[model samples]
Target: MTGFFTVCTMEEEGADPVIAAFYRAALEPGQWHAALRAFARLAGGDVACCFLKAEAGLAPSRAHICGLDEQAWEDGYRRYYHAIDPGYTVLKQGMPGRMYLMQDYISARAVARSEYFQDFYLRAGVRYSCSGTIRDGGGLTILSAHRAAGQGRYDGRTRLQLQRVLEHLPNVFRLRDTAQQAQVHGALAWAALDELPRAILLVDACLQLVFMNQAAQRLLCGPPLAPSLASATAAIVLRGGKVGVRATAVQQRLAQRVRQVCAG
Candidate 1:
């Protein structure tokens, strides 16, 4: 399990609560906001983000950010600054396991003049930063933490603390990837079942509908009733009281199938 992450700048008063939050987040990558927020709090920074490298012209395969709105990140930074981000270029060449403070690769004076910094980071209020890269086969994971202007640079102690926390990030990411793959596989299986021509319906123990395919949705219910297989069948038999023989037979078969599925 990933351990607690602590920073030199934040008050010790809130350390216990922050550490607990980090543990929960590390175990569940779906809680990206929690993870990034915890890291930002630890580093005394305004924002933090994680990036997964991607192929040319594509945005990072995955981007998790804290303290920044989705619109600014996706529309502004991802659309423009990503094309010529000096920090990203530096991350591409960074050695695995080593953390690089912004000052090491780009001087403050140069950052002030660079288009990426001037047009994006400056407006975003990011000044001091530290980043690290972890290479996994052909993939790269980058962690970028930043402080707003006037917050001063990360000192030696902060750097050491960040390095310690970075060491466990790869393991946490591995768990997240595995879970995501499982979800994708499940979705694919359901999609294949949905493509069948028969109006299939899966109902629960209470005879309430759980799932219905596109075919089932189109066949059963009309505008007046619930547009679903079970509801349509019920309305036809109980309310209309004049369903066709073939239609009634099909409904009976569907009911039997639902019973068999629920039994198993």
Candidate 2:
């Protein structure tokens, strides 16, 4: 509410740079928190958050949050809202960028007339809310913010600011996903993938480094820095006191046995 701290408006030239910063930062290894914090700061809201659903059959996860200090923000912040909140179920009827009051939504959902209104949001000082969704080829993501009713709900200007930035939110989530996959894959490459007593060598019978567990890497310099999935099923040295055939063959056999066991 202070004049010195003006929330950036969508129509303002300053908004574009902020938008680009978040878009690029979302792709970085550990910069998501900063990007969301900046967004919440610029929005002057009590909470600004991003949610993403990993797969079609899986529930969504709370991947990012800013300006809230509560116990386990992830649950109430992600799956719980969609699973139980009537306001969100009805938000689908509204236009993408248009701002609407939470009361308008709850009223439409008959929440205003329901037994759950007071205990739900009012006692917690969360009254007004605005939300929007963006989708990529595979799935959709939601961005939302909430504020006390006395603070006023998001106006058209606020909605426009958010809508403009969130136009790129899907791409942010994509890059974030890519970064996470890279990190997990990187860890797996170094992890002792199974309880194999033999130090494995991830190599292609045709001559390529595919993947090596930590035990395997401790034996050699490490499977090549790059492991190609195509080269995973061939015979390679099973070094480091490991008495199995080349890694590729052993892994293939192990996988085949596991499949056979499952089948049986």
Candidate 3:
């Protein structure tokens, strides 16, 4: 997935400042925790998480916890509650991008009696949760928000607010996937270029060398910017003294050859 699905409820240009901040956090790498926290705050929850479940029966491939102690999350959710979670089956079978309330499937009475509630939710102070799925190429992803005990179940307004975020999450994942794929493809192309026999150097618009072929290294390698190649065909864009013993005339011919090779 390259980008998250963006819910159409708010436009970036004229949206509330908080929503704008949330969008920035959601799109940035390693900023999901902040984004989730922003979501929880807006949706009336205390804790939020975004996780990937690669396959049925397997632990989540990845999870980002927002507004929860790491230990509490590990002990209460990752280590145990997930297996017995009442919402798992429902969310698993639910529509990919639709929001679903956890309380609807498991009543408070049922939660009070369940092992997950007694050992996990109660200990962590969470009494209710809501979740929505975001599609991923590798597996299923779920975004969950939790409210503490005494906070009461999520209300209709909260659900509507969460749905706005949910509707666009899938697109976010798609954008991320597309970016990653483009990066991988670019790396492969660079590797192919590196395999060419002639020395090659790639310089950016700033004239700073960003990449050099192995042949280039052998030809001119005291340091970057210190070209030491003896070939005149090669553009010896150097910043140091010449060490090669080749005749100047021969070096010029080789430099020309280098130029031709690079052009080809």
Q: TM-score of every model?
A: 0.59, 0.51, 0.60
- Model 2 / residue 244 / CA error / Å: 62
lDDT-better candidate, 1 vs 2? 1
Superposed Cα deviation of residue 90, candidate 2 (Å): 2.7
CA RMSD for every model?
19.0, 18.8, 18.1
Distance from true position, residue 120, model 3, in Å?
0.4
**Runs in model 3 with CA error above 4 Å?**
1-23, 182-264
Instruction: Evaluate model 2: give its TM-score.
Output: 0.51
Q: How would you encode candidate 1's per-residue C-alpha lDDT over 1-264 as one tens digit per residue?
A: 111121112234333334434334543565678777877776788798887776354566578899877789898877877878887787767677777888777987898789988888888888878888887546777777898878878887777667766765664555445445657676743453355443444445434555666755565544444545344244332224222223666557545644664675
Instruction: Give the candidate number with the greatest TM-score.
Output: 3
Off by over 4 Å in 2: 1-14, 53-58, 70-81, 94-104, 108-111, 114-117, 136-138, 174-264
The TM-score measured for candidate 3 stands at 0.60
lDDT of 2 by residue, 196-229 (tens): 3234333333223455445455444444534563
- C-alpha-based local distance difference test score of model 1: 0.63
Instruction: Report clash pairs, candidate 1.
Output: none
